[model samples]
Target: MITITTADAIIHTLESPEAIADIPSPNTRAALQAAYDAGHWELYEPPQAEPEPLPPDWPAFRLALLQSASFRLWSEALPATWREDLKLAAIAANAEALQSIYTHCTTLHSPGHTAATEWQQVADHHRIPITF
Candidate 1:
């Protein structure tokens, strides 16, 4: 009359010869042993929890956003050399220049302002700490 809640408990009970012998009914003892030997007890594993999603790769994401068509079009108003310099600064991870660019892009009534505003919302949603 073992109170079995899990497969581990069944395994523990099976390990004790004395406990098996103490079972007064031969049919019950044979059935328990048969169930163990047939591997039916292996099917009762506890459900595994899903792993949490990883955070975004912010540096890569920011760089990609900067390279997007909208950003490129916005920066086209600048001279060719300055546009190249901007790309280089982004590649070099110049935080000050990136912050300045973010501020400039998000200016009201500016070209590509809508795209910049959407980007700012994404940054906010991700709790990015960059100050503009």
Candidate 2:
């Protein structure tokens, strides 16, 4: 299970600029600050999704991370920037992504190499690692 522990920590520090000032990821901290500056740092209950929908914008999506750190982010709050260095660490996270990864794990556990490869292919087909 890929337990994204950092997301929760990021949300906790949202209220206090000084609190999130020093965390593991500098970009995460900056995103939180941007959210605070934009006045959308407060948490919110993510919309219930049958299969988890991806947010339209990645930067906005990154800021909306909550205590539970749901995959969905407030796309409207994202800043307008095209910086190549700007990337979202959790953009690939969602129920569908989890399920796909889980399926790959299960296939690997079953000792079915070919099936596991297929599942792995499906999982890797769209997921792009964030580079910062």
Candidate 3:
């Protein structure tokens, strides 16, 4: 089962066998549903469908990200050694890696980050980078 731990809650793919119990337990469907309503779990369906691959423009978008003032600004705050690490990580050009770099580069509230859907699509397209 794939699970994403977010600031809000523990999200589980409905498709994952571990997402819910076969039979109803104390916090069974009800709990899961509640969590879903509250944006906790990823989704409620047991076996979730795989997300689509990223569009071909992902690399362009990634390049644009590196050029953003926020990224440059974020990098400026880092130690010289950490800046090199960020540079190496950016070379992967994976969706997750870009987001991670962005998170480190700018405030979480900054705009222009990729959406969850895009993340999935790129991940699906570049499986080798993610290797999940």
The per-model lDDT (C-alpha) reads: 0.56, 0.40, 0.52
What does candidate 2's lDDT look like per residue over 12-56, in tens digits?
423345666666788876666666665655544455769864434
Query: For residues 1-132, could you state the per-residue lDDT of candidate 1 as single tens digits?
Result: 222223335443343333656667897777666655555443334559999866545666566667567666667766666566656655666657766755554452265557666656655554554443
Clashing pairs in 2: none
Separate clash counts for every candidate: 0, 0, 11
Worst 10 residues of 1 by lDDT: 1-10
Model 2 RMSD in Å is 25.1
Candidate 1 local accuracy as lDDT?
Answer: 0.56
Compared with the true structure, what per-residue lDDT tens digits does model 3 show for residues 23-65?
Answer: 2675555666556455554434366788996544545544654
lDDT of 3: 0.52
Shift in Å, residue 1, candidate 3: 38
Candidate 2 residue 129 C-alpha distance from true site, Å: 54
Report per-prediction Cα RMSD to one decimal.
9.2, 25.1, 16.7
